[model samples]
Target: MSEQSNPIRSAIAEAIADNPTILFMKGTPEQPACGFSARTVAALQALGAPFAAVDILPDPRIRQELSEISNWPTIPQLFVKGELVGGCDIITEMYESGELAEVLGVEEATKASDPNVAPEGQPVQAAPLGIENRLR
Candidate 1:
């Protein structure tokens, strides 16, 4: 981003950079404040893919800044490798068709989404619950 951007924009950029797969939604992944957010979380969780979520409820400014950063006027936005992918609808479709796993580079897309899959995917490999909750 250019230096002309605001400080908050810079912070959002930094946050997204720190996380590999990011979801800028209306609430936390575990306890989503909105139906869309909850569904979005479920989609990713079902894929058993590692990802980081960001709740846009704390500061309305964050929501505004995110929109400006991505030029997307939606709350439940998805990003892969710092690139804006799509929103909840897209994720849900991907989850159903097993596209998310491919995008995340998981070997067994169906098995990964299956809860029966051993060694369930975690937020962080070396850090336990380090990036667990999105609300925090």
Candidate 2:
């Protein structure tokens, strides 16, 4: 089915457009199901960026539709301002280089300079708004 005709695709696209920053990952930010997702979540948390997270695990179609929409065959996809910011490796690299903060439009948390450690504080959780599962 064409993207315009698919409800899942429409929902996924809407979710991306509606949320300024969103991560479609294997699990929730608090309990990421994969190492890549964990690392990605950590990077965003460390940067103190509030984003919306959608767990793609509840339904396989979520992942399939997300990947199709993103054109990125990866579980942990980060979208900033309705654009794909890439997966774990890209995020990690950007974090270490401080580019992620620039992309996220937040100050680079001092602790985030070290990829091994998260910022010292209660890691900012994903924002509640626009965080729905986006699946029927």
Candidate 3:
């Protein structure tokens, strides 16, 4: 079977269909293809749990298809159990705070930079408004 037609494709789709948290990235967790991808991967690693990673580089179709599925035009889009979480910028912001781990049901990563506060002398964290509570 072709890579696009492989059962693993559907299996990966189904696996992420209801996952609580997943990141569709350009490379594996161990090796990321871009800086944004790297940041997100590092954040996931900090969560210290097994999460799904889909390399969009292998197939051209998946990029289009995933965009259709999530309506997200970016690679590295995060899905919290089949639900669209956000893009890299949003995920990074959430990671700097303690929210991403809470939503993903994983322990927060140890950070040299505190999510409770910003490094550049920012005051109290602004409440994250658009972050939806998990559906599954």
Could you give the C-alpha RMSD of every candidate to the true structure, in order shown?
5.2, 2.8, 11.2
**Model 2: residue 20 alpha-carbon error in angstroms:** 0.6
Per-model TM-score versus the true fold = 0.76, 0.83, 0.69
Model 1 TM-score (2 dp): 0.76
Please, what are the lDDT tens digits per residue for candidate 3 over residues 59-112? 666676667667789878888877888878888888777788787786664444
- Mind giving the per-residue lDDT tens digits that candidate 2 earns over 1-136? 8765776777788878988888888877777798899888888888778888888887787788888778899879999999999999999999888899999998875444444444445355454343244444
Clashes of each: 0, 0, 5
Q: How accurate locally, in lDDT, is each candidate?
A: 0.68, 0.78, 0.63
Among these predictions, the greatest TM-score belongs to: 2
How would you encode candidate 1's per-residue C-alpha lDDT over 19-47 as one tens digit per residue? 77888887666567877677777666666
Write out the backbone clash pairs for model 2: none
Worst 10 residues of 2 by lDDT: 127-136
Q: Where does model 3 exceed 4 Å of error?
A: 1-12, 109-136
Question: What is the Cα-based lDDT of residue 21 in candidate 2?
Answer: 88
Looking at candidate 1, the ten consecutive residues that score lowest on lDDT are 124-133
Worst 10 residues of 3 by lDDT: 127-136
**lDDT of residue 96 for candidate 2:** 84
